[model samples]
Target: MDPIVEVVALILGFVGWVMVGVALPNRYWKVSTVDGSVITTSTIYENLWMSCATDSTGVHNCREFPSLLALNGYIQASRALMIAAILLGTFGLVGSLVGIKCSKAGGENYILKGRIAGTAGVLFILQGLCTMVSVSWYAFNITQDFFDPFYPGTKYEIGEGLYIGWCSSVLAIAGGVCLACSCKAGTKEKYPLRYHDRGTAYSGAAPSRSAAASTYERNAYV
Candidate 1:
């Protein structure tokens, strides 16, 4: 496997993992849209974990969501998926560290290392998919509510958290694809090391001048 490719893939995966962690605790997954309000005393925002509001004076008030079961369906799913994504990223990070060609952890067995790297790539892809689904589903709900005229509930716009999640997902998937392609690295090789057969060209090359000249004498027949 190419060391450079392994390094690049590892970097992307690590960055993507960090981005997921950042996006998860972010408080602005959704912010109340102020388009129709004539008087806005405060703006409300929320993430999977909590709700917050900032007054016109810039003072902020925040509270955690009291009950997990009471939250909206998309919110719950998003929370679960994001958590799962983080976990996947964690495992992927470990795998990449052990599998990379430049790393000394997995020894000199390149084929095994390549397989591990490919597995890491799969995990990264899974992490990206989870993040992508969570963000997109949340955004879809926001848009659905925003466009509905009769919807009495507070309408919110997609916030920075969602964008961050999307970006993270893209990076993770891209890195995964590159890494996954490396699984084929040692597949075409018939053997890890070549063997010299007795009658092959290698045999001719192995004999020294004296060895080639020497001949075994057969015993005289009775």
Candidate 2:
């Protein structure tokens, strides 16, 4: 793998994982009331784990939600998925660091290192998917709630955390893909056209020998 590409991917994955961590604890996934004109009293901001209300006087009151079992399905699922992604991303980061060609921690086995890097790439991809799914699901619910006319509650608008989650997901996926491509390139370099050239040479030799044998037989007959 090219050292530059490996380093770029590693950086992207690390940054993305950090962003995910930052986003998870943030209470900015949605905000109460779509219109800023109705700032009469206070505003509420919510996330997977908690909700916070800011009064007109700038006093902020925050409240954590109930236990996981008591939360709604979407909230529970999002929380679980984000946690899983974080764990997987952490493991993937270790693998990536050890497997990167620029690193000296994984011994001198280049092939093994490449394999480990590829595995890390797969893990990163999975982590990205988990984050994407969680964010998308949460966004869908937010949109649904916002558009529902029958719902009597204040409509919430998408928040900064959702945007951050999206960016993190993209970064994770892109980094994983780059690492995977690097692994493929390394594999190709290891066995560049050796088998194909051997097969072509063998085939060419066989045809020529057969042609010479036929000529000799014809001459013998004549």
Candidate 3:
């Protein structure tokens, strides 16, 4: 595998994983949108787990949702997805460290290492997908509520947490693609093109037995 590409992908995956962790506990998945209404005395914000409000006085108070069952459907699902994403990232990191070409964790069997790295890549991709779906679903609900004039509830706008999650998802997917490509490239070097189609090594040059013996001896020494 290309060591440079492997390292770059690992960096991307690590950053994305950290971003997801940051986003998960963030208090502002959505914020109350006042539409420039200065008269609006208090602004409210919420995330998957809790709600918070701040008055013009700059004092803010937050409270966890009273019950999980009472929370909105999208919020519950987002919570699950984000947790799953974190778990996937953890496994991917472990697998990546073990499988990376420069690492000694998996020994010198490069073909096996390549497979492990590819699996890690797949895990990272799944992590991105889960995070993407969670944030997008949450944002969709916020917009749907905000656009509904007849809806009696307080309207909210997308917040920093959702933006962070989106960015994390993008980084994760990009990293996974890079890692997968690197692992795929390793297979080419594992076998020479002359023998690739034949699924076996070239027997050697068509020549005298003595020449073949000499070639074999040189190969063995090398």
Candidate 4:
């Protein structure tokens, strides 16, 4: 196995950590909203009740449970996850490159190397999908839209940034895979040492000076 593939696998592992540990949850919060303002309630020990006054009664009530901030946090986490996924894809490309090189280097068969490379390709494709969704979310403020659906209000969307980030990630992974595979193909050569054994050559051939050695042995004995 090429050292590069190991490095790439580590990088991919990092990406996975970032997504599961940070990003996915953030995005979820970003795209969601918690009911508040119109809903508020004061709680008593061991007891809680919700009451709202209608227009006819002329009484107002509030309930507090859902937090918008928390929902926004989820959105942020989701974006982070998308970024991580893209980063992971980049590593996949690197793995492919390593596999290709190994195949060509004669350490492993081309078929095995190619399979590894193909796995990386699939990861890149998945990353592309994630990037698309992330970019869309950033540009359209999908999170905010999700929260309000119909409300028209000023909000921020980092669509361009998200799209660019995703693109770079995808490119890195794809390029790495291609490079590794090509390297493997180009270096493919089964060395005579490991394959067809030139037994004498490998084991050490009989000395060309054998006749001279015999004469010297006789003289020494005399």
Candidate 5:
């Protein structure tokens, strides 16, 4: 297999993991408010409503007390996974480069290199799948729950940031797969194209009768 391709794929895999490890857990993501007032969890869940205070319209104001620690942990884990992804991506890129270099060298190990590249690509794909699943879950469920505790009452609209995360994961996966393909080392290519012994060409045939006889005589003498 092309060593360069393998290296590149490894690097990409690393990067992919890194990305996944970094940006996953945020429960109360803030968007613009209708009244132009910045609506954030910090603003809403600031004070204690000990007296069950009501507004001018006599509406009981229920302030939210979302758990930040749980969200923080999820986010940290997701971010760590993202970092791993980034590393994987970098590895894949390096592997691809190695594969290209090996191809140019016209070595007998081209098939091996290709096979290696293919393996790396498969790994990259697996990592990407994981990344997608984690990010999707966090964006839809964890983060949504953070914002609105009401079950079946909240619909999460994935923002641009989540989209970017997905895109990066996809890119890393693609690069890794490509590198693996480039470095795949096939069986035939792993072996020599032509079989020869001591500069004598060999055909897929038995030795000539005279040559066999000579070998026998030599053995007999020994």
Candidate 6:
């Protein structure tokens, strides 16, 4: 694997995992008025596991939501997917680090290192898919709620966390692709001459009578 490609993938995957972790605990919405102005008197933010409200005076309080079993289907699914992505990303990061050619953990076996790197790339791709699905589903729900005309509940706008989640997912997917590409066959040149052919060439022998007759026939035809 090219060292540059390996390094680039490692960096992107690490940063994406960090971003996802940061976004997971953040609130996905901001309580706002119908006029689109933020309600500073009481600001609310929410995540998969909890919701928090901050007062105008900077005082903040958070409360955990109901158990996972009681949560809505989308919420439950998103939570599960995000958590799974995080775990997979963690393992992928470790595997990538060990498998990179710049690292000595996987030893001097180039083929084994390539396999490990390819596996890690697959893991990263899976993580990215999980995160993308979770974020997109949650964002869809938010958009639906925001546009619903019949709902009398407080109007909410998309929060920063969701944007971060989208970016992180994209990065993870791109990194995985780069890492996978690095597992392709290298450009190193192969031996041009076969061993047996080299031996035959080295062991010179006199031409047979059949070869001389064939040469004479070819000359006569020409």
In terms of TM-score, the best-performing candidate is 3
How far is each candidate from the true structure, as Cα RMSD in Å? 5.3, 3.5, 7.0, 14.4, 10.0, 5.0
Q: Of the pair 3 and 6, which is ahead by TM-score?
A: 3
TM-score of each: 0.84, 0.86, 0.88, 0.38, 0.47, 0.81
Q: Which should have the higher TM-score, number 1 or number 6?
A: 1
Q: On lDDT, who's better, 2 or 6?
A: 2
- Kindly provide the TM-score of model 4 when superposed on the true structure, using C-alpha atoms: 0.38
Question: Candidates sorted by lDDT, descending order?
Answer: 3, 1, 2, 6, 5, 4
Best by lDDT: 3
The Cα local distance difference test for each model comes to: 0.90, 0.89, 0.91, 0.47, 0.52, 0.83
lDDT of 5 by residue, 1-222 (tens): 445655565666666555554433322232222232354332211111111224435555544445545445555565556555556555544544444444453256655556545655765776686567656654665356546656553233444446656865776676567565654443445346544452354332346766889999999999
TM-score: model 3 vs. ground truth: 0.88
Residue 29, candidate 2: Cα error in Å is 0.9
Which ten contiguous residues of candidate 4 have the minimum total lDDT? 43-52
Q: Judged by lDDT relative to the true structure, which candidate is superior, 1 or 5?
A: 1
Better of 2 and 6 by TM-score: 2
Instruction: Give the C-alpha lDDT of model 1.
Output: 0.90
List the candidates ranked by TM-score, beginning with the highest.
3, 2, 1, 6, 5, 4
Per-residue alpha-carbon lDDT of candidate 4 for residues 1-222, written as tens digits (9 for 90 to 100): 354653554354335334333333222222112234364332111001111222324554444335445554534554565656656665665655555543354356666665566566556556655655554555455445546656765222232334454554455444444444544543464464455567666445446467679889999999
- What would the TM-score be for candidate 1 when compared with the true structure? 0.84
Tens digit of per-residue lDDT, candidate 2, span 13-132? 888899899889888999886463744588899999888999889999999886878888999999999999899899989999999898998998999999999988888888889999
TM-score of 6: 0.81
Question: Which runs of model 3 end up more than 4 angstroms from their true locations?
Answer: 193-222
Model 6: weakest 10-residue lDDT segment is 185-194
- Answer with 2 or 3, whichever has the higher lDDT: 3
